[model samples]
Target: METVVGIEDTEDGKFEDSGVDRSSSALSSPKQISNPIVYKLVRVEGDGRLVPATDDEVMEVGDFLECENSEMHVVADTGQSLECISIERSSSGNLQLECSEGTAEADMGKLNAKLQYIEQILQKVKEEEKQRISCGSPVHSHLNVDSQCSADKFPAMDGKVQSENQEIPSIASSLNYTHSSGSIDQCSRPSEGVIESGSSASAVYSNLKPDLSMSDGEICLDKLSIRELHELFKVTFGRETTVKDKQWLKRRIAMSLTNSCDVSATTFIIKDNKIVRKFEEDSSGNLNAASLISLENMTEEEDGNFKDSSPVKDCGSDDNRVVSETRLGNCSIGYELEDENHQTEQRAAKRIRKPTKRYIEELSENESREHNPRLLISNKSTGHGHVSPTSYVRPAARNVFSEVRIYVTRSDYLGGSDVQIPCVSRVRRSRPRKDNTSLMKFHPTGMSETATKLSNKLLEHCSDAGSEIPDNVLKSRMPAKFHQPASSEPAKEKQCPTTGTAELRQELRPKRADSCSHTSDDDIVTVPTAKGGMRRKHHRAWTLIEVMKLVEGVSRCGAGRWSEIKRLSFSSYSYRTSVDLKDKWRNLLKASSALTPSPADDGMNSRKHGTAPIPEKILLRVRELAEMNSQVPPSYSSSNLAAGAGSVHGRDRSGYL
Candidate 1:
């Protein structure tokens, strides 16, 4: 008989070969296999520390060995367990294992205690889900009914119950109800529900809402291109619209002109805006009168016709119109009338002319004729009018006055006794005489004999008195030597009696008597003689002492004439000399007197009081020596002698020596 072996049972409840042929063709062939199941390696430690395991290592739990390629559940050590629910192998050789539902392994009693502790947490999650879907609306309405029904039963069913009833070995097994081959089923699937749930969360983050029209209809902000929207925005609103206001204005404009026709069909007429049309019509009739007047004045000045008629009245006239004709012609006679009138009036007025040299000469001649006379008198005629009428006429030979020897004294009685005799005779110019004999005859003497006798007596008295005789008597008493007899024979025969010889003899006799009488009175004659002489009478000679006394007396009396001093008399000549000498002596004496010592007489000592006494002896000695020598010595040498002598004398003579 052949030895037979059956398959052993694994702890995961799968078949496993206990013994098999070695190196045989049967060993290479694939045997029967179960569906892939993934398991979860749950960490039941208090901390989340995991034991690292290698992909090639067979994970062993309490009594089971996890299959490397199958989904299984097994209990592990170190407070952790492994449940293999599904297995996946990537192209890169990465092994992925997923866990089954309700497959955890831990201390059963402790896990049960933790499950009781998490009872409130389960209830809170249920409350949150209920609040999320309040108002009888499900949060995800498009979710598949099977998946939602299964997920809804999780909170009511315990882990033990789930483990016995439905064992979801992996996330892939659980997701198989809604997916296929790792891709989500879009048809009859809940992907939109999931997406909408996430979208609601995103909308809360960005504070934005989806537009229902964009979802239901064919509209999307993201689908609209920038160029299409820009044109739409400009047409609905304006070209210059902002992004924020553009939407609003576009909506309003779309509502207003939604049916507007295209403007490209016909030519568009651009009518003026209301303001421009109004301004044009108003400005047409507007005119400033002042501006028009100013323009007229400007034209008048430019044409050189500032006084032209007002342009308002002449604005439409042809004469006032500015033409091409030259305006220079209008200024030709404008100022002629004023200039001609001035010239004509100027021509009618008279103008004074300056006189010529010939006229000046004629006037000068007339003035000369009026001022100076033609008749002129001579000096001879003027003298003739002053001549006396009773002047004598004499013969040609007797025209010369006869110098008769007649003696006329001062007492001559020619006119009267007191008459002033003509002591100085002048020749009279006589007229021509008829008889030469009468003219030659000497006229009777103008003095009478009695007068001649009295004059002789007077001359004798004057000589006796020794007084100065009058010059008139001396001249008259002298003889006139020239004589002439009459031209008759009898007058010629007699001598003329020697005209003044008798008179002289008689005058000489009285003069001799008067001289004899004058000699007898000596006092009278000599006193006058002494007065007339140049010599002075000696009363007392002017000695030096007397001269000094007089000077002192006169000085006390003040400056006066010497004659007024009763102490002395001086002759006229000596008196003047004496006065001058007194002045000189007083000056000399003042200098000498000032040198006298004071009563204290302390000249020998040094000037303890800072004062010097006068040196009287030295001054007197110097003066006496000067008189003897007749020369003044040098003041320095003299001053030394004076100082020495003053000292000696002051000691010798106490106050005076």
Candidate 2:
């Protein structure tokens, strides 16, 4: 295209011009401003080719320059333009200049080239993403990042990222964006470099910046907007804006209206605001990596290879707990539970002020839960093994995702076998599936001696606890008619795990003997499975001692402090969670009230069919407490009735009110 406007000869490199012409087709982007946008600067080499300009290159107004063997000159200086029209940095950091038509064309051309390249890359990426989604591959999950500049940061910038775990502010934030420091920078425009052929210049800056103090490159203050800069910072550095940043991001707009050369093409392709380019290659046309320029999308085979070859990093290596560092479409990360100290350090390093008490508590709880499987089996050796369900029924907490860590426990299953696999612990709230008919299907190799021992302990524990169930409720506790007329079968294979503070971890190898017993088909309680589905819950038989402990705690603590009571008594039964204590207390109160014989006597009697069966001694203590705390009945003297019209609190010589 011909020059939008040509000056005869600027006096001392000054524009002898007025009226900021914004309608000119030459401006890359026209917003009716008086100042012209200066991207990066370039020099008209002795060979007439455009070479990169440095941040320190100072171009005077009307300075002569050239691109593609054609002569060009500085058209305007941003700082000294007009009284009502001076150049200022857009939040994006690009200089906002008034349009005069002569300059924007070059910028628009570069922008167009970059846009086309990115669009091509994006189209390819979209297809790949669709393929992955169709194949049911997990989309990478986003981590809870601190000091992160997503929606809550850089409100003035224009870019965003997509996270499976978070709501990033905008798509514009996802662009290969970055920012710079310092104030109203200056840029000079060449008088004749417009490629009047088509669309405006697609000029923008690369996220990289060189050392400003050591170069003879042309000096232009052109760069990406502040928003773009901040985004680039987060993506590239894995951090947000700092107080004293010194980034001098010189402009690297896609070359336009000029000869294609080493200085023209970007060293990297910026697709979806990410650096899709290879690091080994510069802006030269020859790239070290070949797939970048290839037209076809990467096949699943290639993706598999890429993922396999990608580096694996643990979170402990960094300031935070990074479970997985996915080098994918964007800079997304994954997280796992960290230690309290590590958590504190991460928060402190980030300077975030959120309260982390609950987080720490949760972490500690998870650590405790990690050892629950073995602990639960070992706990079968307890005082109330046959009485309290709390002894065998472990307390479950919120579901936690822990890496399977297998222990070298001796088991008899699989005919003296040794295998390595993680023992994953998950607190399942639902019942085990009743459909599993064969123990061989579950056990395969049969449990080892250790497993056998655990099963025996569990069986004996259940039997002992069942004995205290007062015989009458045995029918309801066990629905299976053929449960050995001898009261022989196990407690409740149909038991559903209760949801609470229980750490129900499953061993890699389980006991099959618990299943292949003489129990009826209906009594075949499937042990809890880890993955997921839903099954039946067996009632926990509370021992008389456990009931007495609940009564004592209630009497001493004045009720409502189940956690404290649990801590004081029944401390050995780690399975007895605060919720269990509370539930048992409520049941004891009900049973005491039900067995009590009205106002005639204290509620100390025990019924044969009691849900919350307590010992007589404990029942008597409950009655005592009830009496002590009971409100006194009002006096009913005849004088009081006569004086009921008078003051109820008044007393006379006869001691009547």
Candidate 3:
């Protein structure tokens, strides 16, 4: 048999459009035919085939209702049983239907029970709507509520009641939609008293009248989509929200529109440094301290918990109901306030965390290292501007040398008997100057001749001075004899040291054969180099005689043999080393190639300001020798010299000195 399932989507007693037409498939009510209880056909079965409902055919109420597919039998106008086929989803949303297939025989008892439950829901909705209309001026709504029932009482039970009716046949006995005291009087009495007799569909819905009491705003809210509700919510609240629940959005919007608090929003004032909430009361004289304190983290769905904690009264029934409702209202207010506050606290507290001591210490260390003057100076000096503290090795302690001591002496003048102060003598420790030649080790025998002369002179001087001599006088008389003499100076006499004497004598030594000495004529001074070492400052002008000697040595040794030339030909030129010979030869080669024959009667080229004063004849000689040896200078290749040598030989030799 084919089964047709229809669903009616309603909110706050108002029926929103589910796609099914009211006239065709919707259950036509005998009474109020113009405003029928519209049902959306969610599904239809034919020949054991399932046909899913489309948006054009069914209104979706998936968010509004949740149910498992099962057989639900509802009564029809013909007093026949119709089985509720199933539930499903489409591209639109959750499509639900509460309809019954036709049955000739229906249980009268079960039919009456189902009708009564539906009647209760419709009746409760109507009553709530009427209350809302009557209390349009919300100023009196909070205090002058006579029903003493919650506004959300019906909605809280709507889902529970529906689910129970579909599954449990004895749902009438099981479901109790009554509050502690107020609902017993307002809700229970109606179900107990009105044992409505007839099974006709007209009688069942005759009293279930449609409520038109909802305002334009309430009607508009029901028509709005989820996206529109979200926009409205953002506009009402200053921030956007992520919650997708439509009912929540609608309720929040309605409350905001009415300027109503979610739960009663309590105003807090600081009294004596402690937060205190203001007291609220309804028409009845009931204190709600317990409700406020206990509902700190409670939600609206858990409002039933308030009944257990309600104050037990030895008073009249009317008084008790008022008190109970007042407490419930207070709980609802607390829950909303607490929930919002809790969420805000969570978001605020999320990013905050205490830093570890080690982390804090590292920060302080870096800051100190960056700002400290001493560390900055050290880093700058080392050429490492900024570095990790761990990598920087602390310098060792420096020795603090004492300053020269000055002693004051007082003496009496011979004639006047007046005290005369002698000159203040400063006792200073003399520091020896560093010798550049001291780096190389030399044998004593090499300087035996020089040592003997220095020893003889020293002995003669010491013997001549019989009385104790002042250190200053003795130091002044001593000759400034250096350890080594320049190669230009005549060779010193060779004499062995007198090892037979027991007394130690300080003897001056002749420099080793390898060690060269600097002459006074040479502009030699120690200057710091870029790499922090010292080098000889060679700014002295080279004499014409030195150039001739360099040419003679190069001709004998060939251009590349600078060391052999230094030792053999230029040995007397102590200041000039093999490196200096090579450099001079290279310069001579450049000058020889660059110099053109010039008119000077002396057969010498006119000397340029920076060029060495070499005669044209000597340069011609250097080029001739350079070509003969086929040798390369410091930077020039041998092939280039051979090529240039041919050019030089081809030139006029009349300018030769």
Superposition error at 169 for model 1 (Å): 10
- Top TM-score prediction, candidate number: 3
Across 304-373, the per-residue lDDT of candidate 1 in tens digits comes to: 3212321111110111111000010010111122233322332231111111111111111111111111
Top candidate, metric lDDT? 3
lDDT of candidate 2 over 1-657, digit per residue (tens): 111121111110111111111222211111122223122233223222223444333222112111210221122211111100111111111111211211233443322222222222222233333343344332111111110111111111111111100121111010101111000010001111111000011011111101112111111112334454444333332346642232332111111101011101111121101222223222111111112111011224323322332211110111000100110111111111122332233223221111111211121122222222221111000000011111101101010112110111111011111111111111111111122212211111221111111111121121122221212132233333212221222222101111111212211112121221221233333345463522233343454445655555555544556666655554323334567777876666665666566534433344345423344445545544444333221243223323331221122111210
Arrange candidates, best lDDT first.
3, 2, 1
What's the candidate order when arranged by decreasing TM-score?
A: 3, 2, 1
Give the TM-score of each candidate.
Answer: 0.11, 0.19, 0.20
What RMSD does model 3 have? 46.8
Off by over 4 Å in 3: 1-522, 599-606, 610-612, 631-657
lDDT on C-alpha atoms for all candidate structures? 0.18, 0.21, 0.25
Q: Quote the lDDT for 26 in model 3.
A: 22
**lDDT at position 107, candidate 3:** 33
Report the poorest 10 consecutive residues by lDDT, candidate 1. Answer: 261-270
Better of 2 and 3 by lDDT: 3
